[model samples]
Target: MIEMSWPQVSARRLERAGLGAGRPATGTGLATVEGPAEGPVEGPVEGPVEDIVAAMCGAHAQVMSAAEASIGLRADGVTRAHVRAALWGEGRSLVKTHGPRGTVHLLPARDLPMWVSAMSSLPGAHTAAPKSIRMTAEQTDQVVAAIREVLAPAAMTIDELSEAVIAATGPWAGDLVMPAFQGWWPRWRMVMHVAAHRGAFVFGPVRGRKVTYTAAPELAPVTDGLGALVRRYLAAYGPATPDQFAQWAGGPVKWAAQAFSAEELEEVVFEGKRAWVLAGDTEVPADPPRGVRLLPYFDAYVVAGRPRELLYPGAAAARALNGGQAGNFPVLLVDGVVGGVWHQRRSGSKIDITVEPLGDLTAAQLRELDEQVDRVGEVMEGRPRLTIGPVTVGGHA
Candidate 1:
């Protein structure tokens, strides 16, 4: 392996790149309320939602509502309607699919070829089946083939699809059950991701309260390799370690090293540890923009960045993370670092926001926070109600 340490880069410059400070780049999700605010931060970037998704690699969509807000904050004149239209409307340009870390994400349809190729190549990608629900290699192949055969002509709900899998593959596939957040899900559902990773399935529009699955639209072949995806990741959230890359990509460290080696990466010190950035990207902005944002649960910005201590320091870290996991509560970003944690609840037409700062806040910072609160309401199409107080972080308030 090649290694050479370059001059140290300031955290501020690294944050500027990670936060998408000047031009359109990265941000967060969610809503909250306490008091009415004057107005919103004017003129958010205006562009196609797909462009924003592509820029961040992908927006975490485990919570569909939060994902919508994440995209709205980045795109100009975007509303819940625009997000829905882009997702399922005629000429749709995006798809909700399983992404890195096996989490749901809103990825640009145009880039599905690249995502499919890179994600499917990850080590242990096909070995998620636990012993209790274990399938022989040949049986796993049968399951994947059955999924393609059943969903090729029409969309199906999980229950309906599970039935089809059992019909095609026999009783063993349907007999398996696995514990999941929503309850005990059929073990067959676990391997369903295999079909998605192979570009054979994607989330279709909601049929009432249940999510449906459909055949993925055919995408033009992409010649880019896994290294290309790694390059984009470094561009948006770089100056990071290979292990961090593996964690973010939900893959093996060996794969990460291979991808990093393929790029002309330059070494730099991030808080005393060796990290890397793309060659020629070492020039830091003299004055990176200073601002605040409310990032939602599982927002891409919170998930992909490394060296969590720097990003969420001191008490802020305690408030924003639990058991080493982030996104339990929406976070408050003051000048690109996590300064506080927040939560929001809506009643009728009014939305209530509660914010808990890690330390003292200036009057000016509080006012700017109100403005951000208003922006959250605007994105959710609801009235803002702001309340400042102590907030308990891990899980819903």
Candidate 2:
């Protein structure tokens, strides 16, 4: 394998490779979308739902609205309705499930086999759980079986599912309490994702304000395992270190090290530290990415990119990050780097956007930012109005 140093891997080149900047390039095992203008947005962009999900490894869906915008920006003529249809339509192609970092994400349904196999291969955590709340392996299995049984015929809300789990496993399963941001939640709620990870259940349609669950159809296991997952990650966001991969996948560093040890990888330096990339991915684009983009909260680029200091840098970091976490604020990306943070509020048919730049923006940059705001409006299907200045994170003012 060839090895190189940090200076050789420019941020501009890395951004081009990772973000699919400029015209979309194929042959990375990702599907690409092609079409014409639909709404106010221009050009034929690459979208095709499966391709977008594959390119990002998975789109974060903890904030559903943000997730929609993430896909809308990448896809040609994709709207919130289209995304909803993809998720809930009769011929569903995407699944909302617990993914990397124990966070919810939208993954291609057909890729579940690889996901299931790779996620299941991680070594079990060595730490012991509290007996009061911890379910034994057999007990966990029983709970999963109970969930599958309850949802096999029809989908049910968490409350109904909790009751069913208690009925199937006895009241003890619901008796344990775990503290959460919303308040104390039943211990049984904790294992819901565990069931999801094991392919027992998946998020179903919302019933009014309540989220429901349903049985997941069986999928054939993928022959390739952790190694394949690592390759996919590298393909999407590479020149990355093992620890970064571990953090993104919510697995142990040792597991990442073992998985990445396979020989196809080419070693390279990133800011004096070591990283690796797929052998074929080493070439950098000659031209740099231009234009501004309004990336929604938890956008894949913001969430998955590493070397935080380099990506965020100085004041941009302070405004965009909340307690060292990246998703608290919607960010403004100027040439693939965080230039500022922004927030938006809607009233009737008009949306007001407020921008907080880390420093002064040139006249041209401001004009580009305005165009980006218009794009945001198109994605939201609303009339967008701009208010350039400091804006709070979390909520719009």
Candidate 3:
């Protein structure tokens, strides 16, 4: 196996994630959308919003605004409006659904077939609900089928769909067994993510103030779909172990091990540990990545990258991460490693950003950080007011 330093890994990941100093290269396997820069806005917009989301695997949409910021940070002139258009406009280029780890994400509609194929089979999270509340595999299948049938003709709100499902599958599927915040939910809710992963339904256009579910659009499933996703994972965040991939995918380590062995990948000694990268992707950057980046909550890089010790090195481990898990707080990246934690509050057209650095930054990095702040503000659609001080806000759910 070849050897690689943490610096090489970070630099390679930065480039793959389109966060490096250089412009994204064409024909690099990522869905390349040629950026036709429109106005005096400086540089190329981050290709089309769909391409940006696809390249990053998917943008976390647990917090939709943060998800928008995550995508906006990558492009030069693109705004949150562009991201929204891709997700909700007539074109509907992006689909908001449960993605890797069963978390809400904005995935490219074009890639839904592949995503559904891979995620549908993963070992899902163990539910905290009591056994009586849980659906058996067969019963889960029943609920999924009910969802499919109810959603086929038209989109429906959760209430309407729940009634349809209960009527179709009997009261057992609708028993109030699962405990939520203050009320018990119907047992069928246990399989919502499962239903989504299997492409039974997807989030539809909002109806007034309520969210709706629509039957997933049909597409030919990709052959060896898991293999394709594995490659995409490594391409965006390579030189990682199967364990990391499993964590990111919210699957089993054994499953990831099986998937990796099936791939034609090359193993490397990454930071004295065995890790794998895509075949023939061993070339590293001559110089490490420079400059600073402010990544929003649940940014793909902070959540998907492996070996937490490296990405959140030293003091960052304590500041940026929430109980060893990344993405709870927005990360301040200095040279591709977590340098601090930041919080942003937008009031009308102005954004108040507070950054608490773990260590003193060099003058050059500070300058870069200033420009980065403006860029983030542009993406967030606010004028930024930078305050280098303590970030007292708690982590996001």
Candidate 4:
């Protein structure tokens, strides 16, 4: 019955999010049992792309590895198999769904048919471009067709894909090509995929390996059925306003609201503002472990929201949410908040992680950091080394 400020509400509201806890062990059943209100899971788990995206609504898959993204999502009940099934279900091709500032994302393997149906009805694709390039709908459609033909059989790098499209579409194609098409063509050559039912495209390799993209046949006919999943996104990340949904959705707010508002959602006031949550999502245990997590810059977990205040300090939040505006740097999490930053440089089988704690680390905390570095080493092919560096809280260098 009392009014609360955003900070106070944010602090209390996010306190229950359970984001900073490191990866939970398998069989822990953290998510299946009572854990956090955000869903279930103590730490993160590795899973396929689509499953993870389905559970989380939005995923940072474009930038992070399947393993890396899974590690983060395990903390919230999403798994690799789930992600995989979403992308390549039933051995059929999936469609790419583009929204939220025009970047294309992967949709569930089983959900493409309906997604494409709904999206095709919408007009005007948001072409993420610099001030110079302008393209008409007729031109855009032609390019899309040209690119599709080039990418239909096999995956090609962005350059290869672009060359093929240009050869067919003519020189003017380069001037009129939108950034999404430019970004997507290469991925299409690599392997076709769908982003939440919008369109079909491909993804390139990550960490020196070509990332696999696949489509699902079952999802092709259920355009109207995806309303359930849209509502799911709102509940898990909501209590947020519709405007926030639009931004996070990477699509028009009008469409996102229409998708989400079509269902039954529970409303709650979190951090002093109105919010909507899924009717059945349970709360996690209040007693969270004093855990630490290392998150990459532009990682989806933190970027899913419009503002970073829910999970980061004011200054740090601004940099993280720049929306591809700045370079991504790895971050250190002490408990659930960003307490410092870290960087690594590899030389001769050694990956040196230069740790810059916001404050001095306790001996125990230091040891924990060391263990985490070991995991990073595994990720970087078994060369684990550590370094101590001096840095301000928000400073990257």
Candidate 5:
């Protein structure tokens, strides 16, 4: 097994994530933001937003606003508008869809078919409902078919789709079974992500305040299967264990282990345990990632990197993480490890950013943190007011 230091692992992760020094600019055919923030600072840009999203596997979009900051701040000169355009533009090179953990994410549209195929075949990840309210296999199949047929002609709002689905699949499919925001959700609604993963439908543009679903393009054959998906995960966030992979994907550990066994991987030892990276992806930096980074809630880097203890050492383990969850709060990265948590509230043209560091930062680190603040403000489209004291906010604020 190859021996690797923890810092070396973090450095390689930073390099893959395009946060390391002298990162390359790889975003082609991407539009720049319209205007700079009031007090923008020039910084290094890695690439366009789409390419950045692709490299990071996908940007978590559970909080869409946070996702904009997560993707935009990765590159210099990128703004919130650029990320939104990539997602909603004519090219639609980037897409909003269900990804790992069945959560909303901004995935590269070009890669969506592969993701869909792989996720559709994943061992677990299906419509989750109580046994009393669960649909049988035949019922589930009927609901999926109804959704595909109903949305074939054009996009449909949730209400429209719901009515059409019940008409086609029978009223049993519409029985209110799951508790939602204000009322109960229909049984067919439980299979929404399942239908999405199976390529039956993809998220369409929002109409006014309602979300729409459209028929997905015909899917190509599943030539690569789960192996290809695993490789992509390894490339973006590898040198990891099957347990970590399962945790990230919200799949079973046994299934992840079997998948790893099928791949040709190289074992590496870090902190006295074994982990794996792709066969040839063993290079590590002589030094770990330097400089400060303020990652938004559910940032890909914060969620995917493993050895949680190392990434969230000391006070960060408590403050940045909520009950062992990695992405409950926006994290402050000091050389690729969690150092603090931050929160921002937009007030018209200006954004009030409060950073709560778990430890004292050097003057140089503090200055770097300021530059990070400026970059964040640009993507969020507001002038930043940095306060290096306590954030005093709740989880995901």
Candidate 6:
């Protein structure tokens, strides 16, 4: 086990490590995440691009909604539009649901069924309340039946579903499904439950209009296919422990452990930590491009698992990653390690980037920052106009 300093790593290093000119790198291997810049974004011959694209599509299979796909990709440096382009080649619907931990997340098309099953296992809170507010078993059954009926045919908007629940349970709507949390209505909790049980799939939630929903199919049958999906995740963002897998998969620790029990995975030491790596992943790029990238909130690099301390350090990781809220910050990646913070805004064709370095960087660091910013502009279809903040040159503001 060899320990490497976190300060020496940056996002660009991670991106270019062990990547090849062709797509075979992604086929069931430990391939680093890459975002091609200077070179034309083209794959090798013999249907490399299409095959990899198809594989990518397969990895996210069963995902009908775009909103869900967008968020997942956005976590990984791709934008909502990028996901749409990959899926429909034209804009279309995606799925979103109130996931575990009382938050909504974009479900990956391929992993939706497994995710649904894992989420369903979490015991609902509606049954444990006091007699004055507790939902009896019979009442719970009635609500479940009603929800099944309403969702059997097709999905419904939140408003429509709420109305249907209200209609089915009659006056009990205000008390039964919408229980009083110790006497006060827990609307958010109710919404999460309703969304979960219906097996409802979400499409693009048009800006201000109602979000469209549709009946989700029996995702259980297809869930067996997730073996490859899990492999892909581990390969793409790996060197992770089982506990990390459990957290990322939204499943129990036992299940997370089992997901990787299949052949093709090997535990390896990354920076001295016992981390799993895909057997197929071979190349670990040395002397990767040093660049600074301004990542969006909730970027995949930050949200992959619970190891901010591994990614950052003691006090800094604690403050920046508060219960996974690190996604909210505009992260600065210099040399693959999170170096500082950056703010970005677009004004017409010009994208303004303001970088605040946590410490003094070498000349090589500035060059790396330029490379990343250029990529961001290309992805966003804008011109790069960087404004280096004085914070990096001086002390913290």
For 29-144, candidate 5 gives per-residue lDDT tens digits of 22211111111111223337767786777899989889999888767777888888887877777888788888888887766776776677776455455678887778878988
Error of 2 at 53 (Å): 1.3
**Each candidate's clash count:** 14, 1, 0, 58, 1, 27
Worst 10 residues of 3 by lDDT: 34-43
lDDT value for model 2: 0.71
Candidate 2 lDDT by residue in tens digits, 1-397: 4454332343433343333345243213232211111211112132366666766778889888788888777644666777788889876778888888767898877667767777766665443557667767777778888888888999999889889888988777877477677777776666766677777787889999999888775676665546667877776567798899998888899888988886378887666678988766676545555557788888887777777777787887767877777777888877667888888888987989998877788898889788778867877788999998878546321
Q: In model 2, where do residues sit more than 4 Å from their true spots?
A: 1-47, 125-131, 395-397
lDDT of 6 by residue, 1-397 (tens): 3332333232222442222222123222213322111211223212222223222322222222322221332222444355455333432223345444434554433345554544554444433545565555566666656666777776577667667766887666555434444555522234445455335543434335666555554444333334544554565566667677666645566666776786367766665667776664543445543445555555545556335765555544643454545554556655455667666666888877777777777887777678667756655657877777632322111
Model 1: residues with Cα > 4 Å off, grouped in runs:
1-47, 125-132, 181-183, 392-397
| Candidate 4 wrongly placed segments (more than 4 Å) | 1-23, 27-54, 57-101, 104-133, 167-171, 176-197, 204-219, 305-307, 314-327, 391-397
- Shift of residue 29 alpha carbon in model 6, Å: 9.8
TM-score-wise, the better of 2 and 6 is: 2
Any residue pairs clashing in model 2, and if so which? 33-47
Candidate 2 vs 3: which has more lDDT: 3
Q: Please tell me which model should have the higher TM-score, number 1 or number 5.
A: 5
Worst 10 residues of 5 by lDDT: 32-41
Candidates in descending TM-score order: 3, 5, 2, 1, 4, 6
- Per-candidate TM-scores read 0.86, 0.87, 0.92, 0.67, 0.91, 0.64
* Regions more than 4 Å wrong, model 5: 25-47, 124-129
Q: Predict model 6's lDDT versus the native.
A: 0.48
The sequence of per-residue lDDT tens digits that candidate 4 reaches over residues 12-40 is 22333334343333323222211112333
Tens digits of per-residue lDDT, candidate 1, 292-371, equal 67777777777775667767878877678776677767888776678888887889768888888777888888887887
For each candidate, the alpha-carbon lDDT, in order, equals 0.70, 0.71, 0.83, 0.48, 0.79, 0.48
Model 5: lDDT equals 0.79
| Better by TM-score, candidate 5 or 3 | 3
Q: Rank the candidates by lDDT, best first.
A: 3, 5, 2, 1, 4, 6
What TM-score should be assigned to candidate 6? 0.64
**RMSD of every prediction:** 7.4, 5.5, 4.7, 6.8, 6.2, 7.9
